[model samples]
Target: MTSRTLPRLLQTPAVLLLLVWMLVPLGMTLFFSFIRYVLNSLRRPEWTSPSIDNWRGWGNYEYVLYSAKDFWFAVQNSLFIVGSVIALTVGLGLAIAVLVNRNFMGRGIARVMLISPFFVMPAVNAVLWINMILDPVLGLNGLAVEGINAIVASLQTMPIFGGFFSLWPEIEPVSFRATQTSAMAVIIMVTWQWTPFAVLIFMTSLQSEDQQQKEAAILDGANAWSQFRNLTLPHLARPIAIVVMIQAIFHLSLYAEIEIVSRGNGNKNLPYLIGEFASNNIGAASATGIMAVVLANIVAIFLLRIIGKSLMD
Candidate 1:
């Protein structure tokens, strides 16, 4: 009946609810990872069911790590895609934030337009970018390339300038859907969608920066780049770290965009690889899921350490 005791008791329900919410699926995933739980088996139909008799100690893990050809590539590609998106988003976000932080005409409108991408459904974003923007043959990419070639052709018709213009080769738009380039497509689209989130966070952080300190730095002959590099950047370190961590965690689970864009192509990340395995091999899929969780946790731990250090300073 003590005050503190009652407060702790009141919080217990919420804590228990959250634990159950997280632990149930996690427990199932772990259990499935260690057993032979395929979706179908014509000869050994019993293998389709989950039973103690189907125990497989470390076989699934071994298979995923050593046997599955796509597992390693998927993991590597996942990390590459997440890292590229984080770099591009943080860089573009910081620049855009700085550009729009100052008062200007239609600033509110511009902010809304930029943020609109973040709110778009992931599926729609994927469709729009792939079909309307990056399709090499029919999209804006091809059109722009064709327009440039036309202008070059016109310039080549000029008698004196013909020789000079003819020396230039014709350009072709790059196809982002192929195996060699699908990862780049995902990175570009995700960056476009997430940069606004970074911009919003950075802009908020910018407002809290000490203007007087900036003015003092200006008086002390610190130039624009110096102010940003020394003053503005240091002030934004925490926000930048937070933005990177959040984006990393989200992008690690990216599935829909990859599914749509890289369907037949050889491009695959952890989530996509898991989906492929899950088509028949439930055990392998669960193992891949566990591995993905471990990878994500390692990244999260590293990022949290960085954020902790930034906050402390």
Candidate 2:
């Protein structure tokens, strides 16, 4: 075989596999989205199976966009969660990466401890955080508050400070399982699990920073902030953007953590909403799934452009 032909033959299987992987499910989702398919319908059982006879055109999409109560809420929540996670992980990652970049004793151990959280299963992370750390009555939050209140109560008995301490109201431990707090729980757990990933990436990028440039800046009397602003931030720009988009993609479909933390009680992102629709309304689910694809692609296009530019540089 000629070299060109041999290379094409070798690449064919992967290309075909990717095409199948991308198109087959997507095609089915598109078809189902436009048809009145569902898992259950007692009055009109014919609608239970997918058939071209029940084609819905834009009905499903309109239902999802305008009629479904959770559609906009889920979209907003998804963006909110992804945005918060990106902001937090990037900010904390920068500070931690800079602090730990320099060689120090026990640095390896520190790095291990720092990065370990990233490898944890999302469900386990959420469970451990919500149940073990954030539970109002049984977790550390409550215990810490209880301990503080105990200290204050003891202080109230002291003659010198009794009047001052007695005037303080009791503190309450926040129940993160509640409606408003559930989103906070998901955010905290996701941030804890992902910040380490950001740290690892940023730290790796920091190692490649130009030491000579930094030294020159120092000799030129550039302060730490000035050097960071002029040198490090510029160098980190692409990585920062990459990190934000990468985390955004990962968090957009966040499921296991939301399930474990809130179970869609007070918070549901887009993926979770799709899962809810998938239970009985296949048409709505498929339509929402298609919209999800569109949203992901929008973000991916911008991300790929940045990545491509970085690759060229």
- Model 2, span 1-313: residue lDDT tens: 7779988999999999999999999999999999999898998899998999998999999999999999999999899888988999999999999899999999999999999998898878988999889999899999999999999999999999899999999999999987668888888989999999999998899999999999999999999999989999999998898999888888898999888888847689899999999999999999999999999988899999988876866
The weakest ten consecutive residues by lDDT in model 1 span: 304-313
lDDT of 1 by residue, 257-284 (tens): 9999999798999999999999999999
Clash counts per candidate, in order, are 0, 0
Inter-residue clash pairs, candidate 2: none
Once fitted onto the true fold, the runs of candidate 2 whose alpha carbons sit more than 4 angstroms away are 310-313
Off by over 4 Å in 1: 1-13, 302-313
TM-score of model 1 vs. true structure: 0.93
State the displacement of the C-alpha of residue 211, model 1, in Å, after optimal TM-score superposition.
1.3
- For TM-score, the strongest prediction is 2
Cα error, residue 148 of model 2, in Å, equals 1.2
Query: CA lDDT, every prediction?
Result: 0.92, 0.92
Q: What is the C-alpha RMSD of each candidate to the true structure, in Å?
A: 2.3, 1.2
